[model samples]
Target: MAEAAGCPLSVIVPALDEAAGIAATLEPLQVWRERGAEVLVVDGGSGDGTPEAAAPGADRVLGGARGRAPQMNAGAAAAGGRVLLFLHADTRPPEDGDRALLTALEGGRHWGRFDVRLTGASRLTLLGLVGAMMNLRSRLTGIATGDQALFVTRAAFRAVGGFPEQPLMEDIALSRLLKKHCGRPACLRERALTSSRRWEDRGILRTIGLMWALRLRYWLGADPAVLAARYHRG
Candidate 1:
């Protein structure tokens, strides 16, 4: 993989049992691959042929430890790029997102994330509000979530020791560490489209409440293992 400036970029997608949407998720990224970006799909022991489904679109399809943090770390370890972008299985990057990320780095930011728009069966109005609130919160707190498509330079990532190996809140943890090492994120205006199934499955308001509660507990020193179980149960 090679960029015009000799700075290679790698997009890492960590998935588990995502065979149903893996192809769609990787499709748009092919354009980036054409531009010398290496696209890697790290699967967490999916029994549904996710690896095979992902192999055609990705530069490398890797088997990794279960959980987003570990799987993403595995991808980072195997990536050959000077810059890394962590994308979720259900998220779609904006047009020219690869260039956007690289441009942000070129402008001297060490790490950044795109704003996100939720897409699914939910009403557009409510979803729009949720997406706006999320973007606003991230900008205010200088924290980027995985759904926002977080990107970082190799040096910054190494300085922060990568994402913490936790079951939940790994993105939040990584953001906090990155902020300390590299300052606030770029917080790009471009939006990545993330699935709204999380909110749609459980009423939108309920999902919001649950997420806030989980964060509050985590901040108060709750065990990530327990939070993970509660999140899954919901």
Candidate 2:
């Protein structure tokens, strides 16, 4: 891991049709912004006012191609921070997340992700199990998903050539690259609270099964475009 003593941190969010949650998502990050960190929102051709809604909380809101990979890459390109944290519109990092990331980096980690907590209005007992399983799986596999709030130093990110511009599994793809080049990530115990709307709306067990199937297919060298289409259809 490269030394990142004085480089500022940047929180990069990729959004699309996220008007309802954009403000809430960026709100907590305002404290970090005030402390010299920058927050950038890259909108992926949102029909709703996601970009406008994000402007108040973000240092800059820019338009980009309609995909998480592209939008996030755009944000990274424009970001001024030496360390970049990629956050989803429906996720919120734990309090003092900036310090946590910086501390991890200073301890010699090039890239890492937080443990995730899935939350929703529904009373789903299995949600706890799901989150636990996710954390454990990431620890074992050295593969972190987008929901976990992935962060990496600028040098490491550029070395991996950023997230692969794939239709699906871009997070997984980037994780593999990073693990190959920079070694295993620092698995922070502090959780990033991620929305469980997908699981709740799509049925928790069904979503789990689908995810496993998708992952298996992806590992089997299936086309990401087809997998993405299948994911959206579900």
Candidate 3:
């Protein structure tokens, strides 16, 4: 059970080879933990000292299978909080993110997600439209992306069987299960700011095309492992 105003939240960051920004990504949690939030950095075999970088600020740096779904599942298993938040390593939660999460949980919903903002000044300027579109579309469809900072009650997460342990689309996949079992997720007002490294590294237009193609293929029942191959290759 949770309080009317706030509840203990466990923030799970699934990381992989993210040494460059892993420390910075987790540093905010020092304050969060003080405020009753627990932070876990679930790393999936990074060669670049990502786990070491996260150790300074994270409540726990846990190793797991090399994939976001499995890693996040591992984090959820070790969580001690009432609510479990799955955060991407490259995304930063909003100020007072724990409060935002607690607020979301009180609204007669088992799960919810924050909107997202892409970071980097120029990148934000260029991708602002894309981010806005994603937020609007996600709200309408009730399918949240991982960068959006999806959260669910521990009971609800277990009820839905956690993430699918697939190679890709786990966030959307989880949303689908929640939709069937729990109804539409509460869409929060606060937004998580995520680095635009994926779009920047691959060129925005090209990455956009690749994402659409991959999604289309996945919708057409293409194997996730095959789609993940194309995604990683791109």
Candidate 4:
């Protein structure tokens, strides 16, 4: 596939049964494609035809084993850009996101993530607060989540040995490694809009508590396999 002119960013989206949102997720990426960005959708055995959904919008659609980490790694391996962006299927970047990424890299920022806004009709103040806290915590801790649309230069990604092949917390593991080796992330101000469907379906309070508890256990040396199971159960 031909890349858009002057842009060298390759967006990697890992998918597993994400058919519902894949098209919407890839639609906005068309603008980036116009500017030389390539979109690669790495689907992990999605029986729901996610690859078909993404194929029309994405530059390339590749199949892989069923796991986010591994699927992401596969995309990274096939990507032909100087930079890599790992985006969730339920997230969409800001209007000028391509420019923002190029500008950040031009300004010597190696790796970073966009702030995220939860989108939905839930007028729950808690959701807003949660987003605020997430942005703040990420800025303070220099950690970026998949929902935040994490981006890194190819060199930096290789230096960090890529995302870990874990079921849960791959984003966290990548963030920690990036901080240790590349310093704090750029923490872009422009926000990516992420679907609030998860919070809407699962009780918001319950989801937050569960996430925090999982992180605590992970930090305390819990096995990722166990954590993954817990996450599935939740």
Please give the ranking of all candidate structures by lDDT, highest first, separated by commas: 2, 1, 4, 3
Instruction: Give the 10-residue window scoring lowest on summed lDDT in candidate 1.
Output: 1-10
Q: State every prediction's TM-score relative to the real structure.
A: 0.95, 0.95, 0.94, 0.95
What would the per-residue lDDT of candidate 4 be over residues 1-234, giving only the tens digit for each residue? 233345489999999899988999888899889988989999999988898889999989999888999999999988888889999989998888878987898888789999999985333688887888889999999999999999998889989999999989999999999999998898899999998887878888998999999999998999999999998787
Model 1 lDDT per residue over 1-234, tens place:
233355379899999999999999999999998888999899999999899999999999998999999999999988889999999999999979999989989999999999999985333588888999899999999999999999999889988899999999999999999999889999999989999998988989999999999999998999999999999998
List pairs with backbone clashes in candidate 4. 4-36
Q: How accurate is candidate 1 locally (lDDT)?
A: 0.92
| Runs in model 3 lying further than 4 Å from the true structure | 1-7, 121-124
In terms of TM-score, which candidate is stronger, 2 or 3? 2
Candidate 4 global lDDT: 0.89
**Backbone clash count, each prediction separately:** 0, 0, 0, 1
What TM-score would you give candidate 1 relative to the actual structure? 0.95
- Which parts of model 4 have CA positions greater than 4 angstroms off? 1-7, 121-124
Clashing pairs in 1: none
Residue 171 of candidate 2: its Cα lDDT?
A: 98
Task: List lDDT for all candidates, in order.
Answer: 0.92, 0.93, 0.87, 0.89
> Could you tell me the lDDT of residue 168 within candidate 2?
97
